[model samples]
Target chain A: MSAPSQDLLARMALTFEAQQFLYAEARLLDTQNYKAWLELVTDDIHYWAPVVESRERRHRAGHYVAAADESAYFDDTRATLGMRVARLGFPGAWAEVPPSRMTRLISNVEVGEQGAEDIPVRSCFYLFRSRLETEEDSYHGVREDVLRRVDGELRLARRKIIFAQSVLTARSITTFL
Target chain B: MTFDVSRLVDLENGLIDRRIFSDAEIYDAEMDRIFRRTWLALGHESEIAETNDFFTTWMGADPVIVSRTAQGIKVMLNMCRHRGGTVCRVDRGNAKLFLCPYHGWSYNPDGTLKVVPGLEADYRHGIDPTQWGLLEAPRVATYKGLIFASWNPEVEPLEEFLGDARFYLDCLLDRVEGGTELVGGMRRWIIPTNWKHAAENFVGDSYHAAATHASIMRVPGLEGAGGRVKDVVGYQAALDNGHGVGMWMASEDNARGGYGHLAGIDDYLKSIQDQLVAKLGELRATRLTPVHATIFPNFSIEFPFASLHIWHPRGPLKTEVRDLTIVDKAMPAEMKDMLRRHCMLRQGPAGTWEQDDMDNWSQTTYSSLSPTARGLMANYQMGMGHEHTRDDIPGRIDNKSSDINQRNMYARWAELMAMDPPPPQVPAACRSHSGEISR
Candidate 1:
């Protein structure tokens, strides 16, 4: 591939903007402003995090396999996620009663254009959570997303989350990653 | 105060001696008495479709290997016979040999001794590899598609043990033609809570759903559409041999209608209703919707959604849970996929409904650890002694909200614990009130 010209360099500048946007999204989660966080997603957003099998090395085929059709931790459309957020607001959503103290570190942004307005971006994340009287629960994963630039704002259209731990030690993912 | 098995539970009253939730001695006794003798669920047969395929899990605290060999399916202790190390560390896979990472001891898929590092040079008199095969469970049986094993060779037949619970179990497992296939990987996690808490809840705690899972029923815009939520209209059965099944439905078609949350259960079951009717008759086909049954100690299956989990007792105050989404083999892969997604969101390890449950269970377990709280007894007085049997459902059934299911489970638990005889003696100082320790 030829080196990027000045125009390509300018387009790549969007990478910095994308990183800033993710940081802001993380801040929303950390501050427990999940209601507002919904604004960052498109109306038709599809978020999924498939369950990972703990297979033997020989059976793994030398790579990690996460099937989209299989059971998952989170597979929410815009409506489902909205309900989920609304549920979190309910006093009966006891899992978030003493809402989990969360810190999401997003890094390693790799971005490319999907269409004129949609950008497919991939990044790694380390999510740390602390619940009532518990030390901490750490969850790390890779998130693949398609972000659409709607009216100069990047809105998540789709997300495919893959976690590092096939056998999760956390009691629950009380907070969004 | 230490464990006093005799007072661990009050046999006469319906009070569960809270110490049983955190006692080391009672936990130890249970490992030998109840867990060893009872039929515990391991995995579905469909999980290991091909020969050499295996699914690893726990039967209580002991790690067990369920593998399919050329001969047949084998359920054996995952511990190495040579040095007691884990023979197979992986969860599920196709493997030719069970190799122990510690001492390089390998066994065939059937757990027969294959190669032991340097067998030829190590001993002058050759050791008998024949006597060194993996310790297999004495009794292993399957009904519908769910496989269960018992450590006691003399235990009752799995069918006989399951008894009336079979009728309801068939509603889920036997619904599919070629039986059920375990879709999706097992979701395994740990919780600091007694296994009994989870087991007893599934045993029959239907009342908790209304207040505990209100959010699930009243999803955002669809608040009063109510999904599958209904008034207390179903029954709970304390089946033969300690097993219990709690069932609730809104008529026939609307029974499991709220399972997937996407396609609604009526639409999903409509295609399979004929098959279910042919297999289970009209009443069972439509009536048995949302079923949650626990096979005694820790095996639980949630129906329509088709999620099965085992609460493997880690200690008196800790548990390791492993779950999987199962679907009928004859169903289209897409529908199975949908059920898989539904089960995940509804009750997977980090599920919306499940997360709420973890909060209560974990907190209760933590509170019970305090010395001041260990002696208190939990009540099981919902519908004891006064529950009536239903005409359609088999076994002694009660209203969905009644605590009879929980009471009957403790009755069975008391029976099983009595079988082991109060551990010979309890420390004199640990004794408290009559049949209970009041710290």
Candidate 2:
């Protein structure tokens, strides 16, 4: 009926479409189809998980791992991610050989601001991941994503995860969360 | 029955009887002796450097709140005296006072009871606030920003507790001007193994590095760096107080030379070398390169990598491990970021190295629970007769990578377990409005 209403409906449709793309990406991870999952990311994508501490600006006050000083977990280019994937596929990636079955439950989808190129985009995710080997194995965190539309196909330009639990229960994080 | 302590003395020769790991009675004795008496590492001083800052953790099975007060740092029992309710809930934060959720009782960060809800009108004279503050741990002390507390008052002083291990620690901690700081947030995970397994792994288990992390070494560009998956050249320093450090020497064939073989270790280590040579002479500086050690029961610091401190809280059949990693305050931002990534990738709940270790640890616990596996013992016979007293070094330095550190740990465990129960301290005299109660 009205031009403004029509524009609002069209925008909503694009947002929903972007949300569906994220859900599909999560499904690929849950199924351990990392090859298909890699196809969803841009070539120069940054996957970072910054360690959040109790105190502000005090670098060493809260970290609990040897490598906490310098890098984010999974800080890598496409090349590094490929190397990790290759290691997983290797016959002796002992950590993942008898791969722990996982389920990545992503929810609370909401579309956010569009990027510079007017790439139809959104950001919203809560990933609750669990490995089937043990009762105490689980990880749940929120992800802030930047999606870019290339040739009418949505792809992840960047993803930053912030974990809710200060103390993790999983024995080892062999799979992506 | 012929009496012989030799069977129990396998620990002296760096040979641990596997029974100590799976025995219910030994674990129970350890709770009474080791956990109850020793000055357990609670948290770092930096965790609560400012007043009102607090961190909640467990000392053995007893929940504890380590807080910074106007007076100083205070480690108190987390349980409220009134109704056993936890005074602080969140993992950590800055709070002036802690108010119990079950009841409205409140306590200052110093652990003094400050308020009781709705009490003035009803039996005001009977309720004395002074007697109801959170219970203070018997002893609290710090060594180079590392905080430790003891439940038993009769336990030895902190310096004496550290004993010979202090000499080795000075090589790492004292080398830096302000000492090292913990970076980012702690990467904690629950490994299904007993605490001893994790402690021994870090203490003197360079022997397993090559095999456990073979894939990490296989990474192409990383092969040149001496940080690869090989045990290489290393020496184990076993101290008098059951503490020990393993120093891995750089391979002689490496073109770069010395500790330089490690990845991203150039600047900070060079500074450490300069400081160590200034303080402890060239020989000690060279010998102390690549030092990683466990402080008694569970606290371990790996110079150049990160500090690891584990708290072992045991149930009848399970052990909960709380581990923290420490990085240097002076480290470059990029290095700190790389170290954190490396930590998560290798040791966190989802690290490559941790995966193999956890599987073994869990299986060990599971198999130990089986009926048929009840009396069987895990072997620790490596380097049994091969170890000898070295005149040049201070502590017992084992020539090869061996299970001597684990044996030393169990020996200390047995010593603590066999010690006489410490005498209880006199309770503070209770004061009532009517009069003071002597009881």
Candidate 3:
């Protein structure tokens, strides 16, 4: 790979900014400031966690946690995500009453080709998570992001996280990864 | 030190000595006599149908790689013999040899140590590579596509170990054509509660459906789906070797009524019912319904929902549960998608029902550790004296969702705990003086 062009660097700055945006988002999540966090994404963004299986000899199989054919953990449109965020804010979301603390570290930033005015970026992320009043839990994975520069600001058009641990250690992923 | 056998076997009343749950001594005995001795479900054979296919999972905290070889599916310890490093670290992938990241020592898919990083000249044949592959789990066997492994080499064959459970499983597994293929991948999560809670919950606790998942019934489409929208009916049947099955019938009159009535369920049964009836005949298909049951101790199959094989490892003050859910392979792409969606919504980390269950389970463990709350008995008395022994079946049977299943589980736990040497006892002062703990 040759050195990234200045224009690409300028474009990549949004990717870097997107990384920062994601970092700030993680902080909001860790602190359980979900209402403030909800403003960061577009109304149409899709959040997903795909489940993979290790078939003997075949290596990795199956995609999507439930399965792509099946419903998703949160196959939310912006509206559904909003509703979920609202639900989390309620006092009765017992799973989050104590609230889970999360720290998402995004690194290894690499910019890929631009598609229809949007640049695709890939980065490695390690999430150090802990829930209050419980055992320490964490998740690490790689993030593939598609960023759209909207009105001079980078917004996450799409974000897909492929986690390394097939099985989660947390009591429940009540909060977003 | 040995457990007080007399006190542990109080079957009349469901009171188990509080010592059973928190005692390190009892836990260690269980590891040997129960976890090690039983035919523990490893992974589905469908996972390793082809040579070199492999899946990494834990069999009672022992990391195991279930792989397919020329001979067939085999379960081997994930730890390399050269060093204790995990031979295959990636959750699942294909490779003819498992190369250790530490020293670059490699082993064939068959688990034969094949290469030593510096062995060409450094060792001069001093190390016997043939004997240094991953250690084989003592006993590995399969019933239908469900593969099981045992640490004890002398454990009985999977068929004999399954015994009467086979009758139910055959109906569950063989009834479907081409058997079942795991759809999507297994939804894995860690729960803070003991594994027994999960086993018993799925085994026969249909009574909790109306309450624990009352919200699900309100999900619009599912309200009148299976006639299961309202009152829950419980049916329990205990199989041999402590395995059991339970049906939360739609109603008492229609014990197996509305078997194929639920939205996702009716579709699922329609897709496979004919093939299953063709393969296993009507007798078996008619007897089974959309139900969930355990293959003793750890493995559980939830028909029309998900199939979970669990591994519960007890730490000093904590417990970790690993669950795997499987789906059918032949269903339409759209239906499969719906099934996966339903499962994720209901059971995964973000699942609605799972969220509540995890909270309860975690709180159970957390509260059980309180010094002031210690010894508070956790009640399992949902339905008492409702259990009866059937002449044809191997274990007990009950009319409704009763603690009979939980009692059966504890009964097995007590049995396993008794089979091995007990751990050193703690002083009287350390013991909780409280009567019983409640969740």
**Which candidate number maximizes DockQ?**
1
lDDT tens digits, residue span B1-439, model 1 = 2544456666456677777777787887787778877898888888888999998888777788998888788898888877689988777878889889998989999988998878888864377777777878877888877788887777888889888888888887787578878875667777778888898888888888888787766564423221345432677888878788887656754543443334645566777777878998877765555468888888887775578988999888778888788887887777777677777667756677888887788877777778878657777777767677777778788888877777777777877877842221122433334642111
The order of the candidates by lDDT, greatest first, is 1, 2, 3
Q: Which ten residues in a row have the lowest lDDT in candidate 1 chain B?
A: B421-430
Q: Against the true structure, whose lDDT is highest?
A: 1
Docking class of 3: acceptable
TM-score of chain A of each: 0.89, 0.78, 0.80
What are the TM-scores, per candidate, against the unseen true structure? 0.89, 0.85, 0.78
User: Model 2 segments beyond 4 Å from truth?
Assistant: A1-9, A51-80, A118-136, A150-152, B1-26, B118-120, B221-232, B250-264, B271-273, B314-323, B423-439
Query: What interface root-mean-square deviation (Å) does model 2 yield?
Result: 3.8
Against the unseen true structure, what C-alpha lDDT does each candidate score?
0.77, 0.65, 0.65
lDDT of 3 by residue, B267-371 (tens): 566566677677755544434343667877777766655646574665533455544556555566666566555555556677755676677666665565676
All candidates in order of DockQ, best leading: 1, 2, 3
